[model samples]
Target: MTRNAAFKVALIGASGLLGRAIAKELAGVAGWTLVRTAHSRRDAQSVKLDIRDAAAIGDFIGRESPDAIVVAAAERRPDVCENDPALARALNVDALRFIANAARDRDAWVLSISTDYVFDGSAPPYSPDDPPSPVNAYGRSKLEGERALLESGAKACVLRLPLLYGPVLDWSESAVTSLTPAIVKSSAPLAPAAVMDAWAIRYPTFTPDVAVVIRQMLGRHARGETISGITQWSGDEPMTKFDIAQRIARVLKVDARLVAQRTPADSTPRPRDCHLDSVRLEALGIGRRTPFDSAIASVLARYPEPTQTLKSQ
Candidate 1:
């Protein structure tokens, strides 16, 4: 299909952290129209297209005829996916396939946002070439989605983002938001998980940076390239849950002394070290990774008040 000068872009999950940031970035660009998705038609300019419904998606594509499509909707809760694998697959894997096929049919470029959970945590600093060995249901479902996109032969880019933090546009509370208050309260005596053995490192890119990268990729000429979006952090950098907590506490001016460190065996099954190397992204002229301390400060700057303490065991 011929490329259009004025690109019409469709973002599937425009309300989420990454999606919203991307939408904001795309909003400022000339010759780019962002069509955000909603669950219903009450919202103007939003097509009520559920990714799970292939027919609806196909129809939406034909109607909107966007030049680029970005799929960011997914059941991100790992434990919830484990409880119901079918639903997870439908949203994460099958839906992605439907979108990929639809994008291919319209000759539009597709970008799917993914996670670092695809790794089994056995290795540190995972490269894009590393074979995924997911240990949990969420990771498995995401892997399936990635495979479907590749197999469909669509012009696609799968970006594996590490932990992300940004300003809260909506007051919607999530696990990350819920834990921030507690971290702030205990900043004075910061005690975080001291799982030196349980190592999982990530660049933790800011949401705005991720959005800029996506915009660059979509506007660029490359197709069928998968890149990892992470910073250059080492697994042996003495990182742990405690280290992160301590940093957050420091940034937010919480009582670091109150922070306690512990390692419970029943914690979530995560990779010991899955820091992604963004050598490919750097080469592509995308901005460098955000500094870890700067990222933590940004998070704290958003939530200055600690109304309640995070329940610590």
Candidate 2:
């Protein structure tokens, strides 16, 4: 079970934004077999499993008995988490606990996705060892999940990332890409300008790149090297949502009138800047940061914009 030439892995939350990217990455790997799971959003490729249910998680993990487990399930919306901390804790904290504890029996390596929100944006660049001071419900729940895994005694790695944008079935799938609709709407004649926040700085990392990092880490683990504890991966670009909107407009080749709100207007308090240093993963030679503009273009290409948003040939 420890060192197999090939690996069987279970991917929880396979129907979500990050899960889809990870599923695609695992599909392309040579010697990896994946059992993808879905909850509210069911798909034929994935089995139905509500990760929030502890007994169900135990039963599923016990029956499937995979060599590794990747947890992508989370209530990532800061606003939603702020409004309903209970639901956030249920998925982000409790579900992760069930997973980590279940995996302990099989000694399966557990890789759980975490976020930059764990740190209060004041820090310029946070390291794995940096103490976390989560400012919002979302961050607190995720940090608790990380702690739960650590306490579970299962071989685990908490991979923390920043704002992510990549191939999306819809723009709203990612916080960074969600600005597209408003930016596109602004292109119409005499349309109201699309205003974005210039206050909070975010490093928009690509989901596909994160997926590759997981693959690399799992490959290393399968090769008999134990990859445990906390690690981070993120894009080096530093831009606000307003700046990101402009880039999205540029990719659409549109003359959109976009406005930037210099002040923080979110109901939920946001950290001004929480940049994560990628040195840890970079040292291991396992990470990628596709240029923001180019990556955005690729994502936009996969999902076409409304006719009004497209430029004339």
For model 2, the stretches where C-alpha displacement exceeds 4 angstroms are 1-5, 302-313
Q: Write the per-residue lDDT of candidate 1 for residues 1-313, one digit (tens) a residue.
A: 3344566889997766677678788898887788988553214545677888999999988888887888878888778888899999999999999998988898777788877888887775688888889988889998898888878877777888666656554323333344555555443344452222223443445777788778877767333343422222121233555566666667766554443334334345766657776667677776545666775566556565432222310
Residues 1-313, model 2: lDDT tens digits = 3544568889999877789889989997888889999887766778899988889999899998888999998999999999999999999999999999899987788999999999998867899999999999999999999999989999999999899887766678889878988898999999999999999999999888999999999888888776889999999999999999998888888898989899989999878898998898898889987999898888887445521121210
Q: lDDT of model 1 at residue 97?
A: 93
RMSD of each: 5.6, 3.7
TM-score of 2: 0.95
Highest lDDT: which candidate?
2
> Which parts of model 1 are misplaced by more than 4 Å?
1-4, 40-45, 169-177, 185-199, 222-239, 257-267, 302-313
For each candidate, the alpha-carbon lDDT, in order, equals 0.68, 0.88
